[model samples]
Target: MEGIEQNPVMYDLMSEMAFQHSPVDVKAWIDLYSRRRYGRFVQPMQDAWNILYHTIYNCTDGAYDKNRDVIVSFPDVDPNSISTLQTVLNDVHEQYGKRYLRRAILEEPNDSYDKPHLWYSTSEVIHALKLFLESGNQLSDSSTYRYDLIDLTRQALAKYANELFLDAIEAYKLDDLHAVAHLSEKFLGLVEDLDMLLGCHDGFLLGPWIESAKELAQDEDQERQFEWNARTQITMWFDNTELEASLLRDYGNKYWSGLLRDYYGPRAAIYFKYLTESLEEGKGFDLKAWRREWIKLTNSWQSSRNVFPVKSTGNALNVSQWLFEKYLQDLGSHDH
Candidate 1:
């Protein structure tokens, strides 16, 4: 299987950029507004560049064994034959770059942000590869495993939520507090949609686990055991690893209109209010502290369990479409 190094264009670009800077000039290379020597092929070229970078990132830090032969082929042509894990990841990276990344760039067309930001993280790619390997290279028929459902769902939700976030940013630029609050609440609705689709209610897992824990807690000596069991059960629902569970905990949503209006909206309102007050007092706001506070608040919301009934109906794909359409409608209304 051919890797990015085997591709002349990508190889040359990577070599040039690698020499020019420590982390490589990824932002400048993917700048869509800038004139490219490759003309119309620039988009594809940029996609290839990002794919190469991501592939290299995943292959770094001893994640990949360079000496190992390809365990999975690029096209995976033969059922009996096996290629290296790196080869499989590279193949998926190329496909992901061409499909998701290129489409996002074409759709969003914002040169301010680097294209690689739209791509999946190295851990995400590794998780997918692990799934593929665990299935003996045979694709799973399960809906959750098919087409990288979890990651794809996350990306879809992020895309929609980001649109709303951008709208909120625009409102902030205009100093329209009401519009910012309104749009930010709508932005959080995307998170609600995710919770519904994932069945993230307390009753889904936590309630049962708590009951089990309570039963175990009857003995004073079993308190620690109960805690361990509860932690194990919760982690199992995630990816069965503390790292992955932490990732999901940070990203997963348990939201509703009430929480959005009461919590997130007020938070943003207070921040903006204080920001204005600080400006009036001739004191510049501490942006670093503000960012830390924002992250802390967001994580607090994410950690909160939804004890309410699950509201999302339909399959994952269906719910995704429904939310996306609703997002479009909301964005349209906000545009006017």
Candidate 2:
């Protein structure tokens, strides 16, 4: 239901699983799909797909975006304030007036955050990319292969975003606002770069979404309202104050081009602004204040009449290769 077509490797695996439910030649069908997905699947592609299956597709604890990316996870003022295991040994202290956080805690040594950050080693994804790109030049211009490569690259880079957040948290704890500021920009830059990269493929672009929404309208006023509806579903999910405090704020988060830059990137920038301010002044960060300001910004974007590019600007293969050089090149070099 989530990105099966856009994710080729996932499409193949899920297709096989559907047959397994009916008791068919699962292994044989799976083998055939290997050849079917890419016309003629080679060993390198198979190896790349195998790594993908084990890492991204291997999740058994059923939940959409279970291993949530750090960007979308709740950014705590104190890294140790919230944890995946939130239980009060006695009375639970509340924050945000129990509106956002009822009783989120991390006793003793914190082992996890509010969200599951990773279920696999990021280094393995780098290895998978190394294998995937080895087949790249040979399969260059194969649009299917290029799209899959972009998907793989997207997963790897998103993990890097996790790393950036961790760095910022460390800097924040150390009272090094400068380092936090730099890391925050690096994080936002990566998201915007991802936006540009995803913009190369029309499937991931946000333009079509707004246009389709407008097409449903009978007038300009209705068109903008429709656009807001389309954008809000993915951005805020719920605009009402009560539901704004809902846990599913970023439940529908995606790496769409306009979305990353316009919504997620700006949201994170606002988060960092308040965070850095608290650090510089030697005071506790104001979560309620930040949420109010963020909500205002989100509301503005939802109704604003802005244009997103309908057509892709760059080639997926070229942009992906450039990103490889920018991010994963060091890993490749170190391996050799």
Candidate 3:
């Protein structure tokens, strides 16, 4: 296996499946999980879980459960850049009621996610987020509730950003430079805000990662080397030859405050800048220049030792909720 991951919620299920336990009732256990997850169960929270059960949690793809964000995706004018870039023609055609790209016998980008841009209804996730937030005031003290709230909110915002990215792509096609610039800026700004929200949780910070790597070193040189390895793994991933794409860059992408503000956020900003500039100058976008600059940023970051917060820095619940309402203000009510 290339990597491994698991949902913390699986612990309870695993315990129930132990030899000492009776036959497990999966549905009943899942229902009870909401109660066990948070200190006390609110119907709204349970309703949120049920929605999740049908939506995001319903994924069967073993490759990757989550849909990759636009920041990490190879930039494309259409939904599938890999296909268009491969064919060197606008082979974006409608089929089966959705846009599908015609790829050659061999996909150009060897390192691409096999999943579609979006697999489920983003609106359903927003609805689930609303339900999750309804009991926030009552469950304010529950740490688990706060963590789950932050996660749900992050998921909702990411989905919204994806929508904005699609709009920006459409605007680019229409040659509406103003709309594309505005949409791109707004969505990238969302990434900064997400960094702040994620910074409130320790699990999402970049500090301990570097610190842990440093601990494994015997000398300053080795420490720097280890730190570079740790940083590169999450950013540039590996060196790519002229014929091969960087197979793993951004595959381990995190929503960490320092990483987002310093790496992915700025990286995407550079991409959009070049994109708009190329349009304004009536020239084709220089992909090679972009790759060179991005690699420089990646390597520069890997070598530099920047400080990151190890402890969760703020009230995650408050920060995440404020963000959810700020971006999704038009969501109106949770009556649904």
Expressed as tens digits, the lDDT of each residue in 32-121 for candidate 3 is 888888878789988788767766766665645353676544342322253322223347666326454543333446533242344555
On residues 38-107, what C-alpha lDDT tens digit does candidate 1 reach at each position? Answer: 2333343344334434653334444332311110000111111211111112222244434322221223
- How close to the true structure is residue 202 of candidate 1, measured as C-alpha lDDT? 30
Candidate 2 least-lDDT 10 residues:
95-104
- Candidate 3's C-alpha runs over 4 A off are 1-6, 19-23, 61-67, 72-117, 241-245, 331-336
Off by over 4 Å in 1: 1-117, 120-151, 200-216, 219-317, 328-336
C-alpha RMSD values across all candidates:
18.6, 9.2, 6.9
Candidate 1 similarity to native, TM-score = 0.36
Best by TM-score: 3
Q: TM-score each candidate.
A: 0.36, 0.80, 0.81
Q: Which ten-residue region of model 3 has the weakest summed lDDT?
A: 78-87
Angstrom error at residue 22, model 3 = 7.1
lDDT of 2 by residue, 147-228 (tens): 7777778888887787677677767777898999999988988888898889877777788878888999999889978988
What lDDT, from 0 to 1, does candidate 2 have?
0.69
As for candidate 3, its clashing pairs are none
Rate residue 238 of model 1 by lDDT: 32
